[model samples]
Target: MTTAHDYAHQNQERFQQQLIDLCRIPSVSTDPERKGETLQAAEWVAADMRKIGLNNVQIMPTPLHPVVYGEWLGAGPNAKTVLVYGHYDVQPAVTSDGWDQDPFEPTVKDGVLYCRGSSDDKGQMFAQLKAFEALLANGKPTVNVKFLIEGEEEIGSPNLGKFVAAHRELLMADVCVISDGSVIALDRPSIGYSTRGLMYLEMEVFGAKQDLHSGAFGGIVHNPAQALAEIIAQLHNPDGSVAVPGFYDHVVALSAAEREELAKSAWTDAEWKEATGVPAFWGEKEYLLHERIGARPTLEINGFVSGFYGAGSKTVLPGKALAKISCRLVANQNADQIFGLVRDHILRLAPPTVRVEVRQLASAGPALMDLNSPYMAAASRAYEKGWGQKPVYERGGGTLPILADFQRELNQIPIMLMGFGLQTDGAHGPNEHFVLEMFKRGIDTAICFFDEVGQIK
Candidate 1:
């Protein structure tokens, strides 16, 4: 077998240049004005897949952006087929958003590539394609490989589930490998075993038809902003625990062995503080940070908007207040069921002086891979060979809804989570970057992973 060290060293410069080219296109999926740019990015990815020797490359159309599909099944019918999944779309970025430079133009300095999609997915996905090219160019691949890169992940992948359901036969595989997560630490390699599900909601509280001067309506009318604040405060109690009744009734508790494993990978308080740049960390007093984020369910208010304050203070009671709320649910917690509980809680706690309305924005079920599967064992060996260290098992606080959908539509193929970005890469934040070293290592690791999966019985 070819070693990752030698393959990476041989093609570092070429891979770096290709990534820069891919990052140059502004493929933000949320903006309607960037529709053409989104298509351009999709085409670029499809062209690259063909260049990498992937056969039957095609740009499958969806209601939104296109889905890029390709496959190289030359390893014979007996060989295990591995499906690789990733996204080419990225979050919107602008200069006013604290960006150091133009977001679309990739910049490399001090071994870090800075851009909007560098770490979120484009860079990571590109690395896998490059790895395939390197392995094919060297001689021949031992495993059948398929690529299913999409262009609408940043927008909650609203159409991916439908696409997967419609083309089940085309996407059949022994197992699916996702290269979209981040490394635990820059120096240590980790594997994600599960992801929490998500329930996103928007709440609006209405007081009156229009804004009124505080002096004119002081103490006479209800303030929507105050009412919104009260509703939010009621979601939690003094112990920093969610007060939603029966919220924990359906949640599955982690096993004793799972708890021990989480404890082993648990970050120290100091490290947590440093990573978040906060003076201190706080959460449910009984659970540790890792447990609160990974194993436990959470309710978070992501965004809130109400009255206006520009330059000078305006004493006007806004007519309505809006809030964007999301919950990260653990295993056995259904998104729709949790959403109903949240809505009911808000209605019961809301003051009669104002009317509150809850709107469901999006939702996805949680995903967990069977760790005992042979595919996981192959991946463990692959990471060990690539990183020179045993890969640590971990779970992410985020959600990938389509993963669960894939399981329902296709056969129950064990999903593998593997990627080469770091947590500090600033995926959704300003000046997002992907480490050059990690990018190259990720390519090597992917190549090694293919070889290992091929050996699976």
Candidate 2:
């Protein structure tokens, strides 16, 4: 009897070519000019879903972009249903962004496929579809499957919350699996069980009513830029921790067992320096690098602009200064509470010389998955079978809004982040690529997960 793995191996060449084709489309969702190309990509996915025998395939419309949805529920209701989620949209790219070749033109070299959307999503999402195809070609899968491939994840998924809320029944399942991130290494797989939340804020400081000559107002009038810099300088203490009071009030402490699991995937200082090109690592001295990144909360000054930064030099004191700030919250901490604390601290730090204004731009709560769930166990077994290695568990430093949104709407389904790409895949950057072998293994892994989940009677 021909097995699904056999079918996957037989169609490897065709699968690679199809991924290349999908990567060719310039579906840069954040770019308004690429709206047509984005729609084209959605249609391509919907058409492929139909060809793969998925029923009720449709291009569901959102306010900005559309979502490509499909399902195969041939397995009876008694069987488990797996909801697969991924984004087809990619970050905007061009040769001017330091690309060696055209960003949209998919190229292959040394067993890696390079293109804008290759690793970010097009390749990962396509792997799920191919897995289903292989399973159906051999025989009926023990579990049902559904796909929710969106087009605006790169832009923070502005409309996805509403879309999911309106289609709760249609998208409900036993568990939701997402393959949109990166693993620790090509050979060493890692499952991300938690992600940090976000609180983005914009701050402005105003001093003089209008621009003034430095020679006249330099000593008498306080410079708004100077005030802004002083205020920002106090946001962090000399120890590099946030100075805001009650900042760590609700942070969850990591258990000794969880710390042991994280140690398995810890990057050496040399490796971190090589990747980040930093002179030295700086964070809370009490916590390890990985813990500071995934377990602890953080306040970062993204960027600040003021005065004259153009050409040579200008002798004018600008009327206002602006700074972009953000905080990464951990589990148990409220986004709103963090924002309020930061805002209040900044106000208190601002000198009476200049008027300060802080605005909340965006916010999202943190998400932690139930690692003990049987669905996660199935994923672990699937990785062992497909990747030839037992996977490690890690907490992601980044934030994915969809995870929290899914938890709230889907009755707390076990959301599995089964990322397939490697950390060095260069996602969202120039020369982004996906290893062809990872794509193949990802298909086999997905197949194994579906079959393994079916046994949960």
Candidate 3:
């Protein structure tokens, strides 16, 4: 009898091809033009799930896009069921964003495959399906399996919460395993114990109904552009800390031991500058580079649109200005509280000449897994068994709303964040790619994890 590991290796070529096929679809959730492509991706997922022997596969509809749900509950009553979570949606990408090849076309160079959704999740999610196929084909799986792959993750997973809430009995499981992020290094497989929360908001400032001539009304009236700039400037202090009155009141400070552990991450200022092309390093003066990003909360202006930014000189003071801001919250901090504080601050800083409006776009609380649980230990052993390397425990700066929901609603079930992609994969950025080696490792790890968890009660 062939082992699942051996079966996974034997089918590596086919797995790679299927992943490329999935990545070929431009399932960009935010693009209205790609709605059909998104739905096509969903149907493709359902078909593939059925081909892998999974039953009850369905293309569930949502307000915006569809979610692909499937399961295989052949395990005995004493066995555990693991809910696998991943997203088929991808961030918008184009050639102009600095890609040497077609963003949607899968291109292989050396040992990696490049495409828009290659790493940000299509490939990673594909690995999950292939892993199960290998396990079920090689031998009987000890634990039941279910997949909740969605198409709206890039757009903040707007409708998944309602779906999961309304289908509690249908989606019930003992745990959820997600492979949506990246590891600090390929050699170092990390399991995320915590993730930052998000609070996205939109700010609009209106000066006058119509455009005004800057030459004529330059000094007389306040420019909404200038007003917006001034207001945002007050958001941060000289020391690079959020200046909101209650922003840091509930921030969870990292313990010294925890800080020391995170400092062990494979991050260097040179690598950061080389990747981001930033001239210098800057952040909260008190915290280390890793601490500021990994554990500490942050306030950032994602986008800003004001007066004329066209090609030539147009001396027109636009009637309105708009800005999009986002905040990443840590432990003990609530999104509602942060949104309220930031919105109130923006409104109070506005001048009488401009009318300001703050809209709370979306929000989700942070998640921290209990690393001491039996399931995490099982995950650790699975990694060691699969990759021959001990896994590192880490906290991710990104937010996974579904992880928070699974943790909040399914409080008793454990959630594991065993990401298999590498940091250089460029997940949501230009030239995103996936390492074929990591893809194999992800499948092996998933196989072993199922076997390990099945031993538990």
Candidate 4:
């Protein structure tokens, strides 16, 4: 049998070309204009699965964008089925967003592939496909594999729950693997053991019926913008902890062992500050930066829009002010419950002069994977083989909502997160790129995972 290393050496160019082809689709699910592109990307993913000899490839339509599902159950009835989950959709990008080049046009610079979806999901998702190709070409695949790539993940995956619920039998698997996040720093293969939940909301404060001259109405009326600022300020206390009542009631405290493990990961506060270019860093007071980001819950004002001052200062009191807020929830916390508490707190804190209304934008439950599961052990060994280093177990500050949904719908099957990307890759921002070295390593890691999974029994 041809070894995985030999297959990788021979197919390196083909793997890179596939990622370039996937990046050129412009699959931005949030924009209406790119709806066609979203479906086209799904088609592209399906076609790649077919090219890899995966049977039963189908584009399952959703209310929004479609999901690409394919499976190769030819490993026989006793073989364990592994469901691979990833998204083909990408966050919207444009030249006005400060891209060094066209976001959809893939470019190779300094051994990095720069594009909109280069590192987020498209690049990671393509890695799994190439892994399958290598396994098939080498005649070494030992377990059943299924692919479930969706195009609406960037939009909160609003319809995925229903779809998964509808097709439980088809998606039933011993384990689910995801490769959608950054690895633990460069040269460290990481496994995401948990992800914080998300509750995104928009708060709007209303003052007058229309804009009024600041000189005339500044003292006479309560400015909605001012009220909005005050309300946001009151969300946290002087100590920098969120002030919402019952907000942390359900947050499970981290264990001492977990804290020690996190501390050993070589994350320095000075390094974080330098990376963010921030003068200083502050969080919930006592925790380290890694803990603050990964284990602790946080509330952030994602965006705020109030008054207008385009070129010059316009002395006008805006009639309305809006703010987009999101909370990263820790383990055991519920999204709806936390959102309710925050909304009530804002309403109670609002002055009688202005009316405030809160709208829930999106929400997803927190997910904690069992680190002791067989699949995680298999993934660890796979990464060790591929990267020549033992994998580090870690958690993410951001949420992948469908992860929780997959567990709930699939009878609590353990999900394994084994990805190849780095924080410096710039996933959601400008100059987003994926390291070619990591990309090749990811393919090798995935191919190794299949062999390791087969050995588990």
- RMSD to the true structure for each prediction, in A, is 3.6, 2.4, 3.8, 3.5
lDDT of 2 by residue, 1-457 (tens): 2399899999999999999888999999998999999999999999999998999999999999999999999998999999999988999999999999999899999999999989889898898889999998988889999899999999999999999999999999999999988887878998989999999999999999999999988898889989999999998888879999999999989988889989998988888889899888898998998899999999999998989988998899889999999999998888889999999999999889999999999999888877788988999999999777899999999888888889889998888999999878899888999999999889998888888898887
TM-score of each: 0.84, 0.92, 0.83, 0.85
For model 1, residues 1-457, the per-residue Cα lDDT tens digits are 5744466678798889888888888999999999999999999999988887899999999999999999999999999999999999999999789999998889999999999999889988988888788778877688899899999999988899999999999999999988898777766788888889999999999998999998999698889999999889999878887899988888877777777877767889888988899986777878889988887888999998998968899999899999999999887788999999999999998899999999998888887776678888888787788766678788788888878888778786778889789878989899999999888878878888888888887
Candidates arranged by TM-score, highest first: 2, 4, 1, 3
| lDDT agreement of model 4 with the native | 0.88
Clashing pairs in 1: none
- Give the candidate number with the greatest lDDT: 2
Higher-ranked by TM-score: 2 or 3: 2
Candidate 3 per-residue lDDT over residues 1-457, each given as its tens digit? 1388899999899999999888999999999999999999999999999998999999999899998999999997679999999999999999999999999999989999999999889888888888899988977899999999999999988898888887788788998899988766777888888889999999999997888998888887788888999999999999999999999898777777777667776478787788789778878988877678778899999999988888999999889999999999888789999999999999899999999999999898987776668899999898888866888878888887787777766654678988889878998899999998999998998888988889887
**Candidate 4 TM-score over all chains jointly:** 0.85
lDDT of 4 by residue, 1-457 (tens): 2386788868898889889988999999999999988888988988888988999999998888998999998788788888999999999999789998999999998889999999998889888888888888777478899899988888878899999999999999999999988787667778888899999999999999999999987898999999999999999988789999999899888888778766767568788977899888877778878888888898999999988969978898899999999999988899999999999999999999999999998888898877678888999998998766898888788788888899889998899888788878888899889998889888888888887887778
Give the CA lDDT, 0 to 100, for residue 346 in model 1. 96
Question: Which pairs in model 2 have colliding backbones?
Answer: none
- The per-model lDDT (C-alpha) reads 0.87, 0.91, 0.88, 0.88
Q: Name the candidate, 2 or 3, with the larger lDDT value.
A: 2
Worst 10 residues of 4 by lDDT: 1-10
lDDT of 3 at 35: 97
Residue 323, candidate 1: Cα error in Å is 4.7
Clashing pairs in 4: none
Q: Which residues of candidate 1, in runs, are more than 4 Å off? A: 3-8, 31-34, 92-116, 138-140, 204-234, 237-239, 274-282, 302-324, 349-356, 426-432
